[model samples]
Target: MNVNRRLNVSEVGDVTVVRFVDRRILDEANIQEMGQELFQLVEEQGKKQILLNFAGVEFLSSAALGKLITLDKRVKSHSGKLILSNIRPEIYEVFKITRLNTTLDIKDDEADALAAFAALQAT
Candidate 1:
């Protein structure tokens, strides 16, 4: 897949780790591009396991959250898995408030997220 300016995509074994470079995903254009890139990775690149590393991200708009939900559904439909990691507590609290925390697979770090994917593979 092509490189995305908004996202830094990498591979860890069988898992594709996507890191968001933009701190605030609030704009429509950037959000759409981010979602499309993620979809392409799954549909074209056949990435079944994904880890979204939010180490530098500090803000996410509601629209951005919607994009994430859409991406999560796409991954699940393909029988794939998506895990989120390194989300700042404030940003994570948004998920909790929206009750998306229950639906999304969130972890504390990339290593933990990778481990979770490995555990899923073992099951």
Candidate 2:
């Protein structure tokens, strides 16, 4: 497991789960750093299965959302999977409003997200 200032990265089985440490992911620099770290996990570390846990994140700026979208595309381009879990209702609503809910795979909890990954690997 690795802990960055804004992200707590750990492994669950074959999946890398990154949990946000900040309550509000609103800063552009922080958002950019998070995106780079996630991309590194996929591009450099070869961790294609990623689960982003949003339990601590209460607010996110549009910039943060943009970063997430880019990360999602990067993972997909690698023929990998990205999932989000434990999202606050307010944050989930933002994804829904932005129509990202259709494009992203979101789960209710860490267990569910991990199980989804396991299922994917089995098939």
Q: Which one wins on TM-score?
A: 1
Among all candidates shown, the one with the greatest lDDT: 1
Q: RMSD for all candidates, in order, please.
A: 0.9, 1.5
lDDT of 1 by residue, 37-94 (tens): 9898888888999999999997999999998999999999999999999999999999
lDDT for each residue of candidate 2 in 6-122, tens digit (9 for 90 to 100): 778888889999998778999888888888888888888888999999987889988998999999999999999999999989999999999999999999999999999999999
Worst 10 residues of 2 by lDDT: 1-10
C-alpha lDDT score of every prediction, in listed order: 0.93, 0.90
The alpha-carbon lDDT assigned to residue 76 of candidate 2 equals: 96
Give model 2's TM-score versus the native structure.
0.95
State every prediction's TM-score relative to the real structure: 0.97, 0.95
